[model samples]
Target: MKFLTHTSIAFILLLFASTSYSARIKDIASIQGVRSNQLVGYGLVVGLPGTGEKSSKFTEQAFSTMLRNFGVNIPIGEKLKIKNVAPVAVTAELKAFAKRGQKIDITVSAIGEAKSLRGGELLQTFLKGVDGKIYAIAQGSVVVGGLGAEGADGSKVMINTPTVGRIANGAMVEKEVISPFSQGDTITFNLYESDFTTAKRMADTINNLVGANTATMLDATSVQVLAPRNISQRVSYLSTLENLEFEPARGAAKVIVNSRTGTIVIGQDVKLLPTAITHGGISVTISENKTVDQPNAFAGGKTQVTNNSTITITNEDSRMFTFDTGVSLNDLVRAVNEVGLAPGDLMAILEALKQAGALQGELIII
Candidate 1:
């Protein structure tokens, strides 16, 4: 645990040192209203080999409807035993300014009792946006990366997810989503992680490059900058602005503890106030034994058995440490390493410190 702690801290320090904790505008923020939109629709996947849904009512109804649309009539109340088709949900992302005939990838997921979607083909499906408007048409052969097989005795071997598949360049866009970026006189940059200081620094960086009062900090998350109305000039202007480098403000002091994996991450700014902490452990053990009495067999013509139990307890020597006012991360690490505490023990101590108002950072356990 001590080695792991030291290694994590060293890696963090190396990362900060390598980049000087600076980031480009393109990496930290995004152009507002210039993002991808989600599209979804119900579709069907076919051409499976005895691995499709058998008893799903929705799959049957959908299959019948498709057949009817193709001029085939089926008698009412007749169940079709189709074993090569499965109902699926298709999803895709429509990028901003996507033109007609542009191809995009799509994901197909089984929504029935299908055993596998391998070697299946998705039929022509309409991918609709949130407003229920068709934006693209999807139809392609599914490329499955998972494998699945089932035995007659109900045993099955599966790897990854057998019911989901993807098709690259499967959907062709048929409509363009209107964006407000070209309509407004100013383009807004939205920070991925909002910080007031970072916003001010970003605005200042842009103002220095373009001219004074060119970029205005609208809020902690948004920075509005004036731009040309022409699309070509606007595009060139954004290309230059996004590449500009600036130093983002440091994040707040925080300690994150992953309870499941026993991972503790302490930020560089995390400090400890004046306090004392002691940690120890106690363990208990119990054992059971059985014995037989032979004297009862001779006197009463019967033998009896009795049960016995043993209990033991052990405790380790308690270790205590004190922290002065405004102790830094290095000092805390040194003290914890000297005390030989495991990750779980360290987590307990951190929680105790937070409760006692001695930790000068937010302690988050996940």
Candidate 2:
């Protein structure tokens, strides 16, 4: 009996060890009608590092006009000399059912010729939603990720896009977006990704957790759930339903390659078919050297322009390999990596393989 118990424990451990991780419905699906709304507004950023937007007539006009609203009316169309201001568009996300007095992060993007938004303070600006309704007020210092400098002679510098910036907890939610929580007898759930298998699994999970007939899969992207008639018990139902565990269907394996970065990511379950592959890299360089030859001691005429240029072209090719299809992803990755080709080269090879139907996995270039 002890031996049988030990065998069962070993089998259970083995099963656990072989289980693969899958995205859960709780992690991928949101409760029906629960989402954040996008809010955007045009505002200004003050105190920049002289990289602010070029003095546009409209920029100065707006600045002067705004100042006039504060009882200091500067004449419109006057030449306003401003050096420390940058016109920016402020944007923020208004979470679903966000209540008043809640703080949210805001992003400030430069609209003018501002070199960098660094060390800039954004004044209190009202954020409006697409419906043209003011929902929140934002005020904070902008944080840019770029810098610049000048030198007497031509100087080299780095470009990190100093125009865009972000402000953490910069906006305050003043108005709540009206989302009816109790509008009907049923509530719908939306999956983050459209997966038929996941949708069905989620519906089954919910039904099993609540009752036999409470949830039904509507389609690959949505699930309709019949809420409990007792509103008081609905919250409890949802709480337990999200925690239910079940294995998700294994998705198709894929390979994502970034040609520019020479990056290759192999998804689980990637399979390769038998194929012959060969790749080569060729580099060409052309350089020109200028020389000046002057006639000395009345030797000849004036100096003539002399130019020397050289062009070099070189190429290295890899031997063709007949690969076996149906190889596991790890083996395939190891074999390909052993070829010593760069990521960019691998990307081209993957594209060719995919076109030839030699690779069974989906190849996504990003």
Best by TM-score: 1
Best prediction by lDDT = 1
lDDT of 1 at 235: 97
Query: How does candidate 2 score on lDDT?
Result: 0.77
Candidate 2 versus truth, CA RMSD in Å, comes to: 10.2
Per-residue alpha-carbon lDDT of model 1 for 1-366, expressed as tens digits? 656566457546735643545689999999999999999989999999989988778888899999999999889989898689999999999999899999999999998889899999999999999999999999999999999988999998999998999999999999899998898799999999999999999999999999998999999999999999999999999999999999998888999999998878888788899998888978888999999877753476667798999988888878999999999887887787788777888899999999999999989999
Superposed model 1: Cα runs more than 4 Å off:
1-19, 282-313
Q: TM-score of the candidate numbered 2?
A: 0.73
- Per-residue lDDT for 139 in model 2? 94
Weakest lDDT window of 10 consecutive positions for candidate 1: 11-20
lDDT of 1: 0.90
Give me the runs in candidate 2 sitting further than 4 Å from their true place.
Answer: 1-19, 47-54, 152-161, 229-232, 272-325, 334-356
